[model samples]
Target: MASFLDIIKRHLALSIWAFSIIAGILLSQTSIDFRAGVSRLAMNSLYLPFTSFSRTYHLLRDRRVENLRLKEELTTSKLRVEALKEAQRENERLRRLIGFSEKIEYSNLLAEVIGRGTPRMPGSLVVGAGSDRGVIVGLPVIDENGLVGKVIAVNDRSCVIQPLNDPNFKISAIDARSRINGIVSSNSRGKIIMENVPADADIRRGDAVLSSGLGGLFPEGLLIGRVGRVSVPQSGLFMTVEIDPAALLDRLEEVFILFVGIAGEGESGVEPPEAQ
Candidate 1:
């Protein structure tokens, strides 16, 4: 009897708790205010996490954009700095050329070197002045030290010059001390070759060479270079002479274009320069 009473009491308690929970659920579903409050609570819980995720994503995207913009700005700044440095170097070179030009006696136009010729045709350069500037073909170009090249081709605003070291270049030259005439030409190695020098020629090492003005192309008495070596090859009729150019061909930045035509030929009335 005692065990049966205990069992009944436990079952009654459990049934009452179940009935209470069912009653509360039914009441919550029937009330519109209660249902709205539950919906809002659920939405609020999801909103916080979603809003945080969205904010974080946008912040990362903005940072990435900012970094890219900074990188581009840095690159542009670097390029500007390099350009300024290059301009400074060019200005210094032009100033030196201008001072050298003032000392020249002949009427000449200062020209800047714009470009060099292709590898197939080495020892040639293009200048900034051409026919429009009274520049003409066959005009001799010179630097501070001595002769550089001759104008070969011309355009409205630019001209091509064949340097003294060009293989196709040849000029009549003479020994300043011995007064011996020889044909100075350039070899494939861009080295000066003075040929047709007689075996008994008075030419010797360290002798200065000058233009002879024999072909009427180049004027007389322009310094070419000093003879470096002289050799009498076996079975050769003429001696092979090597010369070092007076001008710095490898570092030419500016050159003076000699106007060799008659006076009143152009507006500047440039005349052929006499040998100094």
Candidate 2:
């Protein structure tokens, strides 16, 4: 699996956006049906191996989780206490998922994660839901842990997500404890950070960060991550804030896409490209 991942990282780093533009331009005169056929073939060729790997990884993960649950059932009193704590945490997560669903003005649709993109686009994820299921570009995608990414490209059968960790991604965020606001984005090296924060702000390690919904692009109060490190720059007025994402993004097997969008912003996302 390590070698496989290395191969993908080394050889499959080209962005889909680049592919779309090039295909669209070169095949501008092609019939729509013809282009669609080519797009499907290309998408399958590019992503099928990754999909199989993702499923295998998740199967092992599920087995580990099941083993932990079984072991808890046979444990001593102290271990039983740990089991209870774990149950409570799970209950809280369920309650949070319910609350999140209700708070949204639009409906949610669950979709399976099929693949990942890397190298030039490390944060790209491909999901097995698309236009046929009413998914479009700019829809917010989340899992129980919170915001994961947004739908960026879609066809009849699948779509690609650009997660929060992507270098091209940014959102308005606030410290839940301090109520101080900043823009959350990835730095040059792909680490998530909350920028434009005041040097003297009341942020601390472990402070919960959430989407502020100030820009109207993303909904409010979704957990982005927890604050990690706080440091002041030598010659800058604002401090640097590192953040840890709320979700195990690399392990995501499913996600929920909200049907809401800023009308024209999504526009059915970019359609799969035509072939020459």
* Model number with the top TM-score: 1
Query: Which 10-residue window of candidate 2 scores lowest in summed lDDT?
Result: 267-276
For each of the candidates, give the backbone clash count: 0, 0
Per-candidate TM equals 0.63, 0.58
Instruction: Write model 1 residue lDDT over 23-84, tens digit each, in one string.
Output: 98897678798788887998689676787788899999999999999999999999999999
- lDDT scores of the candidates, listed in order: 0.84, 0.82
How close is each model in CA RMSD to the real structure? 11.3, 32.0
Error of 1 at 139 (Å): 1.9
lDDT of 2 at 112: 81
Per lDDT, the best of the predicted structures is 1
Off by over 4 Å in 2: 1-106, 118-122, 263-276
